[model samples]
Target: MNATDRTPADLLGSALARDPAHPLVTFYDDATGERVELSVATFANWVAKTANLLQDDLGAEPGDRLALLLPAHWQTAVWLLACSATGVVADVGGDAARADLVVAGPDALDAARPCGGERVALALRPLGGRFPQPPEGFLDYAVEVPGQGDRFAPYAPVDPDAAALAVPAGSAGGPEELSGARVVERARADAAARGLAPGARVLSTLGYGDWAGLSAGLYAPLAAGASVVLCRNSAALAPEELARRVASEQVTHTAA
Candidate 1:
């Protein structure tokens, strides 16, 4: 692959080189009154552990589908990059039955029950809390990820032309497939179109099921060397609270 044929993992590596200490993902959960910030290095560490779990523990490989039934939390962002690092195709909001693995948020447990492959669940609580009792038929993400090695080394090279993402059904009139190279290209272009300045801090309240949402939440910010303040349940916040968050976080851009 050419140097220009970039993948999501490549973008993260560049961001770490540019400034590892800079905040890469600032997350807010309005319903729970939770706020968390992760620097590039910290986020990369999480990605590494998650990637190792996928490859070493779950035996996931390139072309294998991982259904991601998650919300727009910091952990979800971590999983997205983890999938990229391990060359697993992320099927956002896809049917669990058709996937090689199913990762579900707490609210999606019932929906994920029928998946035939490995199953993982995230509590999405503060500080990566695990479920009080592990969900039946599912491994808790917070419990499992921390125990994995912090450094990731894929068993094989990932193809830049291989499928990387599958958008949710009805998005872009139907599901859309994006290759690793195309994912990066679209991210950079979207960042440019949004006028994202280098190292800018952007706040977004978009889900990860569609192209625009995924770009704004993760890829576009990384592509522009910017950071993301991902807000979940933004609808539950008042206008004053939203404004206050933006001001407090020093956010330079907004996406909804």
Candidate 2:
């Protein structure tokens, strides 16, 4: 697929088509010493299903704010894609402040409720064992996903000038809003310039929440139909572990 024909959804679809069975994301469960792998097809399907759930089940409309506070797990990828597919404005919020909707880990959810209260409409808890009880009106994400349809109709063509993400301004007292279409276009161009192509694997020492790292590490490779090997906090990993993961994953590029 050419750059002109690709959308965020199409990028994921291409990855699924190219390497349906290949592991797209791998994470270690420290408690069990178990490795969890999410394949390209599974990732794509969850993204689509989440998009449908947000739009159809939760009544999230285009331009509505959807704040994400989950860890850098497989679900983070799903939330990013689902927001793009449904045209909901995705905001990466810190532990404080109120957002229209919040997707968080159990601890974050509890902290947010006292701050946000009735202002928050939806509280999506991550899928795992022993999460905090959501307020009476909040919904369970695990149950919500199964109830949603398998697919979602794509949003109308996105406006290049419209705000798509609002990133927190590091201790600056305000967030920096960005244009989605512009970011996507620049990412595609950067990917092409860097020779990030299909089948190649890219790694990032920075977290996915960083603007440049997120664009280059996650979206850029996906835009080029390449695989991404993401580490939430690469700086925390031991040298041997990092080297082993890079070699095992066959990472070709590193963007810090």
Candidate 3:
């Protein structure tokens, strides 16, 4: 099907059905010093799991904002895909203070609590030690939300023109909302126009929170049913390290 004919659900579903074993995401874990890979099927499951958590547990009704402050991790991609399927407005925030739900590591979680807002802490054991004890009345993400189920049923189809995400307005002091489906459609068209194949591997050094990051790094590849190798610490690392990772990962396309 053409890009316009597919929703995020349809795209992901097709990818999973066509090549469930294909690697959808690959990331380098600094702590483990190993590259972690998640296949299309595994990614679909995590997206479903995240959808269940947002819709069933969080009571995040359709059109409700579900902000995230996650770093560039596999879970971040899962949450984005989940939001699309569940009809939740997934807002990617630049900082914890701006987000409705912050899926952060331990240090970011600690720093964000003082902002005094509702947030969800996505616990990654590899990110750090066990979850730190929250102060009085703070929500512990793992404790509050039940584990996601095995199967996920998507919500009703969304209007392509509807607002899908909210981004920070540059120097404007407020958030700017954008159409999710439109962005996906455009990106898909662009990728196809560039002759990108379904399973092509892409190297992206964009930060996870920004527009380019979300688009080129995550959505673009997924929309095209391709693989993405994301470098979260691109700015801090040397050029050689970046080159090594790209070559090692066998990246076919790059948005560097």
TM-score winner: 1
Q: For residue 70, what is the lDDT in candidate 1?
A: 96
Q: What TM-score, to 2 decimals, does candidate 2 have? A: 0.79
Among residues 3 or more apart in sequence or in different chains, the pairs in candidate 1 whose N, CA or C atoms overlap within 3 Å are none
The parts of candidate 3 lying over 4 Å away from their true place are 1-6, 31-34, 94-102, 110-118, 127-146, 155-157, 192-195
TM-score quality measure for candidate 3: 0.82
Sorted by lDDT (best first), the order is 1, 3, 2
lDDT of 3 by residue, 112-207 (tens): 564444566656544323356643434555555346786787556666567776666668676677666676786687677645677788888777
Worst 10 residues of 2 by lDDT: 117-126
Highest lDDT against the true fold, candidate: 1
In order, the Cα lDDT scores of the candidates are: 0.90, 0.65, 0.69
lDDT of 3: 0.69
Model 3 Cα RMSD, Å?
3.3
What's the true lDDT of residue 89 in model 1?
94
Residue 256 displacement (Å), model 3: 2.7
- Please say which candidate is ahead in TM-score: 1 or 3: 1
Evaluated at residue 142, the lDDT of candidate 2 is 65
Among all windows of ten consecutive residues in candidate 1, which has the lowest summed lDDT? 168-177
TM-scores of the candidates are 0.96, 0.79, 0.82
Number of colliding residue pairs in model 3 = 0
